[model samples]
Target: MNTRSPWTVVICAAAVVTLAMGVRQSFGLFLPQMGPALDIGRSDFGLALAIQNLMLGLAQPFVGAIADKHGAGRVTLAGALLYVAGLVGAAYATDAMGIHLTLGFMVGLAMTGVTFTVMLGAVGRVVPPERRTMAFGIVTAGGSVGQFLVVPGAQLLLGQLGYHMAFIALAGLIGLAAVLAIGVAGKPRALDADGPAQSVGEALREASGVRSFWLLNAGFFVCGFHIAFIATHFPAYLADKQIPPAIGATALALVGLFNIFGSYAFGLSGDRYPKHYLLAGLYAARGLVFVLFLALPLTNVTALAFAAAMGFLWLGTVPLTNGLVSQIFGVRHLSMLGGIVFLSHQVGSFFGAWAAGYMFDLMGSYDAAWIASIALAAMAALVHLPIRDAPLVRRPLAA
Candidate 1:
């Protein structure tokens, strides 16, 4: 079977990821406006997002397996349609239940098909082993690009056209992504020269028995918690401190901006360094950054600085984690295995988004959430140290 050029596939995968992730990242901007208009409490809105995360996690493995067998393009196209439908539904949603069905369930499920796991799996399969991490980094960076560009545009739309119309405009962008998904078509027929082909059942059985697989899942959980809490609540957190809404938008944008660099740098580093060590260091640094952000006085400058610092670290885990998976297991079932790992991340995301809002409503502060994030980061750092990152030596399948 013929395949597209590797670079062509990478670019297309990146574009698909850009739209899916960019749109997902901008949801935080809707919170302040959405709550008052829908008569939903912050916790209710947070629950919607929490449900979205859970659904995304729950759907990923199935979607990943489908992508593994069929192709990413079909799944992505389907996801784009669902995304548009969800946005339209969200636009006219009159109550929390409506919001939960549309924004929470539908969009979350769509994300499984459109976001990193499927696209990065496609990229991982096509690229050479040595270049795989950097390719994953580039695709992951594409999401950061979306964050950098889409969040501010979303804020602008929110300011002028209102939340409902903004959803329509974002839906249009997702429709465009459906076109890009065409280029990401085709599943890899065999593993690259480094390994022999393995059946999906064999891959799953192998991964399930490995301790490092679970460790990677545990470490990624912290990443999900960190990103989701910040993405969903940071803007509102800034607003609560009497910071202007525009600054919050700028801060999120900066994160996207810096993340572009962070993901790439880490991807490059993953090729050269021990990825688990890099991951351990990344988590440790996050804890340090959070401590400084809390200790410093609350101000626009400090907030933006924290955003830049956190953004630099944001999504860096994706490339390294993905690369490590490919390193340990081959790319034969990268999408499926990656989805399993990402499911854990999304579980953390569910808590991070929901728990923060729950605590804020009950205690009137996000202090507990921030403290939890710091602690989780520390734990993630420790977990990565014990991970065995060497490639698995599988015996050849019997004829």
Candidate 2:
């Protein structure tokens, strides 16, 4: 088999992923205005987002399975259109059910195409094995780039054109992601990444017996908690404490910005070191950061600085974790299996996002959520230790 141009693949992946994730991340910015416009409580807003996350996770396995069989171009193109439709629907949604259906189901369904597991599966297929981890890092970084750069810009656009127009504009940009997905065809041509390809069912069965896969899943639940809880609630948490809204936005964007560097750095590290140990350390570091942030005085500067540091470490684990999955399980059914693992991540996200809001509503403070994060992080660190980094014990694929 011949290799494709690295630059072309990387650039295309970055462009497409940035547009997709950029739009997704902007949802938080809308919360400030959206909650009021709809006559809903913050918990309601959180629940809607939690539903979106849940549907996103639930849809992933089927999407990944289909992508593994049918190639990603069609699915990606379809997802782009669905994404645009979902956003437009959201702009007009006047009731709770409308928001849930349009934003949760429709938008979440669209996310199946753009999310890291499926997107990185395509990346894993094209890039040589030696370059896979680094390549995945670069692509994942694009999503962060979108979050950091595009979100503030979207806020600016909203400033000028208003919320509805801002969303409409984003819909158009999301359509561009579909256009770019068409260009990512050299990889997943046959949906085969390794020498001997296994069926999706066979792959799942094989991986089910692996102790490490379950550990990875359990640990990833914590990751979801940190990401979604912060993404959905952090802004409000600061606002409740009298921090400026821009400060909140800035801190979140900072996470996206710094992660660009952190993701790449971790990917490079994964290339050389034991990925599980690195994963353990990343989770442990997350616990430490949260502990310190909660214990000290909260200020805009401290919040933003914390965001920047945490952001670097945030999505960085994705490349490392995904790389580890491919390393242990091979790439035959990588997309499907990886989707299952990510489902755990998203399940955690649902709870993280929902629980923070719920806790705040109940206690009038975010103390419980913060404490849970520290505990979950520590648990995730422990979970990573026993995952033996070896290939799945499997019967050969029927070829």
Question: What's the TM-score of every candidate structure?
Answer: 0.98, 0.95
Span of ten consecutive residues with least summed lDDT in model 1: 187-196
Candidate 2, which segments miss by more than 4 Å at Cα?
Answer: 1-6, 186-192, 393-399
Model 1, span 278-375: residue lDDT tens:
99999999999999999999999999999999999999999999999999987778889999999999999999999999999999999999999999
Error of 1 at 353 (Å): 0.5
**Cα shift from native, residue 158, model 1 (Å):** 0.5
lDDT of each: 0.93, 0.83
Superposed on all Cα atoms, model 1 deviates from the true structure by an RMSD in Å of 1.1
As a whole number from 0 to 100, the lDDT of residue 194 in candidate 1 is 44
Local error of candidate 1 at residue 50 (angstroms) = 0.9
> Judged by TM-score, which candidate is best?
1
Which parts of model 1 are misplaced by more than 4 Å? Answer: 191-196
lDDT of 2 by residue, 1-399 (tens): 214565666777777788888888778777778787888777887887888888888889889888776666677788889999999998888876777888778988888887687777777777777788888889889889998988888778777887788888899999898878766554365534774666666677778888899998998888999999888888888888999988888887898899899888888888888889999999999999998898889998889988987898898788888999998987766778888888998899899978888898899888999999999999999999987887655565555
Return the TM-score for candidate 1, rounded to 2 decimals.
Answer: 0.98
